[model samples]
Target: MSSVLYQSVVKNYGALNVLRSLDLAVPDHMFLALLGPSGCGKTTALRILAGLDMPSAGKLFIGERDVTRLQPRDRDIAMVFQSYALYPQMTVGENIGYPLWIRGMPDAERRAKIDEVAAVLEIGHLLDRRPRQLSGGQRQRVALARAIVRDPAAFLMDEPLSNLDARLRLTMRGEIKRLCQRLGATTLYVTHDQVEALTMADFVAVMHGGELQQMAPPADIYDRPANRFVATFVGNPPMNILPVTLAEQGIAIGGTPVAIPAARLAACRAAQVVEIGLRPEDMSVSVPGAPNALPGEIYVVEPMGNETLVNVRLGGGNVSVRAGRDFRGAVGANIAVTFDVSNACFFNSAGLTAVHRVNSDGE
Candidate 1:
């Protein structure tokens, strides 16, 4: 296994800059996901690393070797595409063994390697079938087997689960995570799915507008986003953002004073905080006129089985609150929402995180 590095990598197409001096590092045997929406340069970065596309400037490295100008074949990396790029006419065994065969491995050894990889992916029984004969999951397994048979320095996966059905996607997510762990391989995965990035990767690099937004572990990415873009992008319901005015006591959201810790308040004051962010799970339905509560009307209620998502229309904005499954409230009903000020995130006028609440108890 080998580490991967991108040193000030930039990709420009005419007047459009695709990647803006991106610098990233994937530690040896680490699984890093390049996560972003469409047109966010994630796929471009992966392609540049795989030698399928060249960067306009800067260097790329696999381990200690600079592979900036190397051909794809010489880069010593295996890619699993989103489409499961398997040979239509060739049997599963032939597809998996193709890499070894091209490298001049003996027929017997190539067959053995194919069998070994196929068994590991649990597709050994389908080796004789062509691509059209197998189900989507089985075909994906075959593609994985083909990549694994090469035993390259790093594995590059580009949305390998996007084509599968929802249930199959869930199963394959676990399978891919387990497979990577077992091999202890260096992996760089590119995807737009936040769930996939958060669940499978050791580190997630969130990108937007051809620039790196944040790179952190899953929990940190969700709990302590770097800026407004990251804070609003990574969450499911997304964090609730409200405009706030600085006050002598603390801050005021929609003209309602909210108490905050002295130190945190000072930091926010120093940074000239203009907004506060609270996650859906951080706020709860509270009694009307309660301390540190914002009076609002119920905008909507969604029964999510395990929990009810309540959207309340406050003076500042609509905020989603995670309530108990048994929560029952009428639309337009008067209500109050309260949250821990210590758990709030303060943002500056420039949209950067001014101060973030650290989960000290590790909740």
Candidate 2:
């Protein structure tokens, strides 16, 4: 496993600009998720790294070696695609051991490596089965086993869990993260699901419209998004961004006085209009005596066993607050939600973020 760096990478298909000049780095042995919507070029970026696609313009480096012109096989990388991409004619054992065999490893070593990975991946019992005989999750496990057995420079996974059911996807997310960490395999994974990105990767790169929106640790991306897009895209049920105005002294939501700390207010003097980003989990169903509460009416309640999400309509927009499982708010109920000041984010109307600046390491 090695450091993967993409410098000034660009990809275009005739008039469609799939990837604008992009620069990203996956440090040695760190799992990084290329996360974004379907057409945001995350898959393209993985293909470029895997040598399946050539960049229109850029320099790509795998560790200290430049591999911009290398073929897929020439680069020491194994990829697991969303489709599993198993050889239908081959049994699971054969598919998992194929990479080692092709690299001309001794038969005994290949068998040993395949057995080791198959055992760890819990796919040993399925080894004798063909792809058609195995279930979706089992086939995916085989694909991952093959990639792991290769002992390649890096593993590239492009939405490898997308085809599985929710439970299987969740199961594989933990498996992949644990497997990568145990082997210390530098991995670049691509997925549109924010949960997959946040859960499996040490670092997450959020992309939009063929551009890298922000790159940071998952916690940072969730707590301090670089922009409105990243804020809205990173969290579950999405972070709520309310359009507000900033005066020289304080902030106002819908022309009503909202108490913002003096220091934060001063920091926002430059932006006349801004959006306050609040994660659903950061806002509570205003506990008994909490102040700085925003008034709203309950619009919807969603219960997921462990928690209840209460969507409330503010004057202009709406925000969702994550309530405890015991919370029993009825629809159309009057409520006041309180945002945790220290945990909230703010961005100017231009969409560039401001909250990440206040408590940065500079603090």
Candidate 3:
């Protein structure tokens, strides 16, 4: 069992606390991404797990061993950093075989392992090339090959793809995902990229201000965010959040009623002022006088190749609606928007709606 566990881990620097009693569990062979923006203590947690930094308090375990004070090498972990960390003077083959060489493996065995890892990563043809001679993606693969050759108990990756171009990053995301599945190693990947975390990880632990905000599979994190921060951060265009008053009629924005499911309204009846969340995809331009139509002026329109994003100034706040590519609505034009209440979310003023509320049909 190669599960990585952090029990009430805390890291502090003088008076400034970095990590605040974080308790996390990563199942065996699980690919879990510690995701957050820079300075959120995600990297600190990864460093602690890798034995590069010591925790201020609490136990760290890799499998059944209490590795809280173990050295990096003694922990039997492989780390791939954001820099690729390839040696400029060494060939790709040498780089991949370095760990085995240090372990006193025979040259023949080292060469065989290097060749195997190179072939697995599809970089066998470039084994003779130096780090500088290879492209960014190839160098990244070389770094990965080096780590994989170790066959360590766990793999720690710190923003390993942050250096690649956008196209290469997308390509490598799939490659990394395939590699993790093929090896079935417990991997702890640290990255600020939400797309990478959402698409690759078996589970995602969202960190904010050195605290664990939420941990769950990607779909649940998106559809039902644990709090306002997660709700606003995970989405691409982000959910449109508005301060509204809940009443018997429905939700009201700027004192004007907006259409919402009766069941949702009833569920949040205890809260007077609630923050309503609607994904951009759930809103559309509706015909004037349509049922539950919200009148607003188009603030701006962004035409993506596949769809158009239209920002509307509704009452005191602004909300963006995702429209079809054929949408030719001009900016500043008065338009009506309709809501899909089935997918709506309601949060208290403090920004917490623990359970997702059902619509009228109980969906």
Off by over 4 Å in 1: 361-363
lDDT by residue (tens digit), candidate 2, 26-134:
8899999999988999999999999988999999999999999998898999999989999999999999989888879899988888889999988888888899999
Scored by TM-score, the top model is: 1
Clashes of each: 0, 0, 0
Deviation of model 3 at 217, angstroms: 0.4
Model 3 per-residue lDDT tens digits across residues 250-332: 77876667776565677767654477788898889976678777788889999998999999988758998999999998788
Candidate 2 yields a Cα-based lDDT of 0.87
Better of 1 and 2 by TM-score: 1
lDDT of 1: 0.94
Candidate 3 at 183: error in angstroms?
1.1
Candidate 2 residue pairs in clash (backbone atoms < 3 Å): none
lDDT of 1 by residue, 74-177 (tens): 99999999999998989999999988998999999999999889989999899999999999999899989999898899999999999999999999999999
Q: What do the candidate models score in CA lDDT, each in turn?
A: 0.94, 0.87, 0.88
| TM-score-superior candidate, 1 or 3 | 1
lDDT of model 1 at position 299: 100
For residue 200, what is the lDDT in candidate 2? 89
Segments in model 2 whose C-alpha atoms lie over 4 Å from true places = 287-291, 357-363
